[model samples]
Target: MSGLNLKALRKAFGPTEIISGVDLEIADGELIVFVGPSGCGKSTLLRLIAGLESVSAGEILIGGRDVTRVDPARRGVAMVFQSYALFPHMTVRQNMGFGMRVNRVPKAEAAERLQKAAALLQLTELLDRKPAQLSGGQRQRVAIGRAIVRDPQVFLFDEPLSNLDAELRVQMRAELAALHARLGATMIYVTHDQVEAMTLADRIVVLRAGRVEQVGAPLHLYDDPDNLFVAGFLGSPRMNFLTAEVQPDGQLRPLGLDVDLPSPIAGLRPGRRVVIGCRPEHVEIGDGPLAATVKTVEQLGNSTFVHADCAGTPIAAELQERWGTRADAALRLALPTEKTQLFDAETGLRIRQ
Candidate 1:
């Protein structure tokens, strides 16, 4: 296994920069994920590390060696792309061993590596089948097996599960996590899916508009975001935001609510505009400060989501039990002081105490 590092990594097309200066250190055997919305430079950054794109400026290092200008093949990294990219005519065995064959690895060694990778990926029984005969998940596994046989120092996955169906995607996700644990190899994954990043990554690098926003463990970034952009992006239903005005006593009056709550941050001058953020799960629905009218109720078997309007501001709350709730129902919300987050209205930055 090998560690990877990027120093002031940048890329540009003509005068428009796609990747700003980024510096990150990925530890050996760590599964690091680059997550962001589309066109946010996540894929560009991954391609830069794979040596598929030339860096406009900055350095790329792998296993303590400067590989900024190294050829993709010599950089000791293997990439599994969004598409399976398998040869339809080639059997699973041939597709997995193709790179080894091209590199002129001895026949026995190539065969051994292919067998081991097949067994590890649970593709041993499908070796003789062509891509046409395989399921979407099986084809994806074949692509991953191809990378595994290369014995790369680092593995790069570019939305490798995006093509699978919903249920299959979940299954492949679990398989990928198990594969990472078994190999213990350095990996950098790129995906717009927050759920995939949260489940697979040892650490997540959140990016936006070609710049790094925040980097942390999944729950760390979720529970304590640095900015409003991050706070709203990582959650499933997303966090709820309400406009508020700060009072002299470090209290905030939410625009639609009657009661004032203590500000989670300190030192805000009176009348400063701020945003109050509460996650869907944290917005308790029994009885509290805020009053709302339920607009919709989503029953998800095990749990329910109450979508309500607090005067004009919309909010959602998750309940563990089925409420048999209906639209136009009256409800009260409890925004826990300890669970609330404060952000600058104009700058969209978190206000830390």
Candidate 2:
């Protein structure tokens, strides 16, 4: 078991900074996910932790030892990539045991670890199959089993599920979670998909450009994002942003429609430009305040999404039960006052609580 502590971690490509001063503590046996949009440095940070890339600054401590400059093989960390880097000619068993064999570990001991890992990944029956013979999901399992056989202090997964189909990705996600529970080893997963980050991570690190935006439990980040970027980035279907102004009585006027705000902000001057943010699920269709016209309708059996234009403001609503929804239909929406989030229009900063 191992816990990782990062202090002022920074990475740069020449003069361009990639990871700007990130500090985080990953608990032993915890599964942490790093998520962000493209060019957000999520994968680069993972590589830095794996010793696959050099750190421009800051320290990386694993199990109380600073391994910032440690060799990849000496870091006691193993990684699984999105593309399974399996030897085409080697059978599953050989691929899983190759590292141990190269390290000159006894054949019996190597086989023992392989057997245990294969069992955990449910790849025991496919041990004799080559990469060409196994399915994508099976190949991924072999890749993970390879890492497990190493008995590393930490496991790093860099978008390992991105290459799988939607159905297989979901299946593999559950498998990875179960695998983590069985082993209780430190894990760091990096992905662009917020669904994966939300479901699999014990804690999430949301990054943008080079700096860490926020780090917390999945729900915490979703419920209380530090800035507009995080508030919009964490949810499915994404959060809706509406033009709003802070009123004289400390209320939010969304699209000229009055709505109450829970957190006190009386100091905000009247007509102060602010961005009103709320999730799709928080939007309710009713004969009230905000006005929009339905532009498209998406029916997903379990839930229906209504894409509407709120007086030129595009709004998407996720409904548990779709009773009345039509394309190009005019609709009025009531904004949830207490559940609302406000961001400064100029700086995109969340108005101080």
Candidate 3:
């Protein structure tokens, strides 16, 4: 499978820019996910790469060949949309074979390719069924099946599971991961769901507004966020943030508490305000230096999360086992120095070692 490259790609609607100068190199056969909030330019970027939207500037290259002006079909890419976009009158087998048929692939060859794709997607049994006769998951698999029959070098997906119910979405996520492994093809998926990005991406391109904010492996970004936006966006319940002041001698005074900024953050000037962030899982019930009120407790069987007020700041701390912390009570907690993350309050950049 071949990969794709975007060189300083930009898109604009009149005076407003939607995707600003993005330069990306997707490794061949890699699975990359584009994730961010709505209107962040993720889907627009995908569409740009697919040739659905023209690039306002720069070039798009697939497999090292420039294809900025080439048609999407000629660029060797297939797209799966949020809506299945299958023909109501066409059977599963016909939908999967549609592209080949359009390209004038012989009926015999198209049939052969469709058969293989349907089998891989476990849709062989439903080949005779129309879209209305299939389950949600089966219909989605059929959509993927159609893409597979094209045997394109890159598969582009734009929130393909957003239409499904919660339970089916979870199951389809797993199935799609398995499909990628089996096909060993490069796939570019766009979604606003952080969980989907974290689980499915070999690397995630986190976008904010019109440009790429950060791109890295899921855990790497989770463990070492580049800025406050990324730190806050990737994890569930999000990371906790507190206003702090840098005192003389480069010390950090978190609200209602006094402590020196750790050595990793000593570069920031003293007398500057900063933002301190820590994931809920990083905050623990131990003897450290943070405090909060137990506002509520959520027990999700395997893991428990405690939402508490830390000196007027709502903070969440995780407990491995259930704890008896009732609401409206003081709770002492620890923010393990290494586990805690700090950001420049004004710039929102992570302070690193």
Which candidate comes out best when scored by lDDT?
Answer: 1
Model 3, range 1-353, lDDT digits (tens) per residue?
A: 89889999999999999999999999998999999999899999999999999989999999999999998889899999999999999998888888898899998888888888888888889999999999988999999998998889999999999999999999999999999999999999999999999999999999999899999999999988999999999998899888888777765778677554453465668777888888998887765566667889999877899998876788887777867767988767777667778888889998776
In candidate 2, what are the lDDT values of residues 235-284, reduced to their tens digit? 98888998777767777766644454432355777878888888999898
Superposed Cα deviation of residue 17, candidate 3 (Å): 0.3
TM-score for candidate 3: 0.96
Tell me the lDDT of candidate 3. Answer: 0.89
Error of 2 at 37 (Å): 0.2
Q: Which residue pairs come into collision in candidate 1?
A: none
Best TM-score goes to which candidate?
1
RMSD vs true structure, all candidates: 1.1, 1.8, 1.5
Query: CA lDDT of 316 in candidate 1?
Result: 90
Regions more than 4 Å wrong, model 1:
256-258
How many clashes in each candidate?
Answer: 0, 2, 3
Assess every candidate by TM-score: 0.98, 0.95, 0.96
In order, the Cα lDDT scores of the candidates are 0.94, 0.88, 0.89
Q: Of the candidates numbered 1 and 3, which has the greater TM-score value?
A: 1
Model 2 misplaced stretches (Cα beyond 4 Å): 255-265
RMSD in angstroms between candidate 2 and the native structure over all alpha carbons: 1.8
Q: How many Å off is the CA of 339 in candidate 3? A: 1.2
